[model samples]
Target: MTKSVDSTAPVLTSVRQRTGVIELNRPKALNSLNPEMIDIIAKAVKNWEDDDSIDQIVLYTTNPKAFCAGGDVRFARDNILSGDAQLVDDFFAAEYTLNGKLATYKKPLVSIIDGVVMGGGLGISLHGSHRVVTENAFASMPEMAIGYFTDVGVAHAAQRMVGTRGQASPALAKYWAITGYRMYAADMLWSGLATHAVQDAETILDAIVENGADTALKQHSYVPDGEAPLA
Candidate 1:
C-alpha cells in the first residue's frame, strides 16, 4: 500500500530500510526550493547521517511535473523590492552550503531526476554521487537569462564533463554558462551532465536496496551515443 506523507510539509523525509528517502513535497509550487525547504533538507541529511540505521540518501520529488524548478526567486524578488536584503542573503547562503556539503558527502547520494530539473534543482542533484534520470527528465541552467551566473558547484561539476576524445575543455563549461542551454536525457547522459538514464524510475529504489548504489547503477544506467552536447 502506498501512503502519502504530510501534505503540509515542504519536504517529506522517511527511512526505508537502510535508505533515507527525501521527497520534495510542494507540488503546487513545483517543489521550488524555499528557505524553509533548504533548511529542512539540510537538517534531514545531517540527521540521517547520524542515524546508523540509514546508510544512504535518496532524493526525489513528489511533483510529477518538476523535481525542483529552481529556487524561490519570485519570493526573493519580492523581498528585494521590499528592501529586505537579509532574506535573499540567507537563502543563498543556506542553499550554497547545502550544495557544497552534498558534493563532498561521505555516504552515497542518489538523486532521482524524472521531471524538470533546473537552477537550484541542478545544484542539488548534479552534486550527488549518482544522478538518475528517467525518460521524462529534462534539465537546464537558464540563470544567465535572469542576469545571474550559475552557482551551486556548477563550476566544479562542469569541469568533470569531457569531449568525445576523453579530454576536458573549459569551452564546454563556458558555453553552458553563457547559453544556459536546456538538455534532455540523451544529451544529459552523453555530455556527462547526468550519470545514469533508465527507461523508468520504477526499479531505482529496489535496486539500490538490494545491491548497493554502485552495483545498482550498473544495472540501470545507460549511455547515449553521438557528439557531447557541450563539446
Candidate 2:
C-alpha cells in the first residue's frame, strides 16, 4: 500500500510498505532545494530511520527536466543581496546537515537520478547506497560557474571518485570540482558516480518493488537486456 503526506504545502511524501518514496513536487521551481523542503526531507528520513517497517527509501522528483536543479539560487541571491549573512549561514548549515545524514544513513537508500542531477541534487543522490541513473540523467558540480566552491561534501566525494593523489590527470575531477559540467548517464556510470543506468524510470521502480525490500541490489539492475518500444 502506498501512503503520502503533504508537508509545507508543496513537497509530497509517499511510502509503500517498507519502501518510502519522497517526491520533489515543485516542478515550477525545477524541484530546487529550499529551506522548508530540506527540513521536511530531513525529518522524514529521521522518522523512517527509526521505523523498523521501512527498509528502503527512494528519493525522486516529479519534473522530467530535473530531479533537482540545486539550491534555490533566487533565495540565496535575495538574502545575500539584502545583506543577510545569517540567512546564508543557516541555509548552508541546514542543507549540509541533511546531506551528511543521507551519506551515513543506516538503511538501504536509493536515489533516482533521472534529470538535472547537479550541485544540490548531487548531494542528495550521490551518497545513497544505490544510485540509479536513467538515459535522461545528467550530473555536474558547476558551482564555480556561479562564483562558489563546491559544498555539501563535494570535496570528499570528488576525491573518492578520482582517488587520493593519483597521477592520472585530475581533469575529470577538475571538470566536476571547478566547471560543474553536467555528465550524461553513461559518463556518470563510467565515472563511478551513478551505480546503474536504467532505460526507463517506471520499469526500474517496478523492479525495486518486485525484488523485495530485503534483496541485495544488483549493480546493473537498471540496464535492460534488449531494446524495447518506448513507453
Candidate 3:
C-alpha cells in the first residue's frame, strides 16, 4: 500500500520498500521547474541516495495534463527583465546540477511521463534508467520558441538520440532542437527518446509493484513490436 505524504507540499516524496516516489505537485503551474522545486528535489534525491531503505526512484507528476510544461520561464523572464538576472542564473545552476544528478544516479531511476513533458521536463526524465510514456504524452524541446537555447543537458540528450536512431540524421536533430517541433509518443519511441510507452499510468505502476521496475518495463514496452499507435 502507498503511504500518503503531505499533500500540500510543492514536491511530494515518499518511499515504498526499495522504491522512492517523487511526485511533482504544482499542477496549476503545470509542475514547472522553479528554483525552489529544483532545490527541494535535488536535496531529496541526495538524501534518498544515501538512505538504506530506498533502492530506486520513480519520478512523476500529479497532474494528468502535464508532467511538466517546462522551466519557470515566465518567472525567469520577469526576473531578467527586472534586472535580477541572478535569479535566472541560480535557477539554471540548480536545475542543471539536478539534471546531472538524475542522469548519473547510482540506483535505478524511473520517470512516469504522461503528458506535456517538454523543455526542462525532458531534462529531468529523459536521462534516467527508465522513461515510461503514456498515450497522452506530448514532448518537445521548446526553448527556441522562448528565445532560449535548449539547455538543462538537452544538447547532450539530443546528440545521444541522433546516434541511437541512425535513421534520423544529425541535421534533423539540430532542426528539432532549433525548431521546437512537438513529438507524439510514436515519434518519441521511433527517435529513441523514450524507453517505453504504455496505455495508462495505473497499468505501469501496477506492473512495477508486481514485477519490479526493469522487468515490468520490458514486459510492457511497446517498442519491440515497433508499433506505437498515434491514437
Candidate topping TM-score: 1
Cα lDDT of model 3 by residue, 24-114, tens digit: 8999999998887888789878988988877678888888999988899889989999999987998988898899999899888888998
lDDT digits (tens) for residues 1-231 of candidate 2 = 655544444567878766888888888888889898898889889999989888788887777788988888899999989999799789989999999999999988888777787778888888888788888888788789889888878667765663212223345666677666667765666566777777767667666766753253462354434332211
TM-scores for every candidate against the unseen true structure: 0.91, 0.86, 0.90
- Report the Cα lDDT for candidate 2: 0.75
Ranking by TM-score: 1, 3, 2
Q: Which candidate is the best by lDDT?
A: 1
- Candidate 1 per-residue lDDT over residues 101-122, each given as its tens digit: 8988888899988889989998
The Cα RMSD in angstroms, rounded to one decimal, for candidate 2 relative to the true structure is 5.0
Model 2 TM-score, 2 decimals: 0.86
lDDT score, residue 131, model 2? 81
Give the poorly placed runs of model 1, Cα more than 4 Å off: 1-5, 163-165, 225-231
Instruction: Indicate the residue-level lDDT of 160 in model 3.
Output: 66
Compare candidates 2 and 3 on lDDT and give the better one. 3
lDDT on C-alpha atoms for all candidate structures: 0.82, 0.75, 0.81
Worst 10 residues of 1 by lDDT: 161-170
Model 2 clash pairs are 142-180
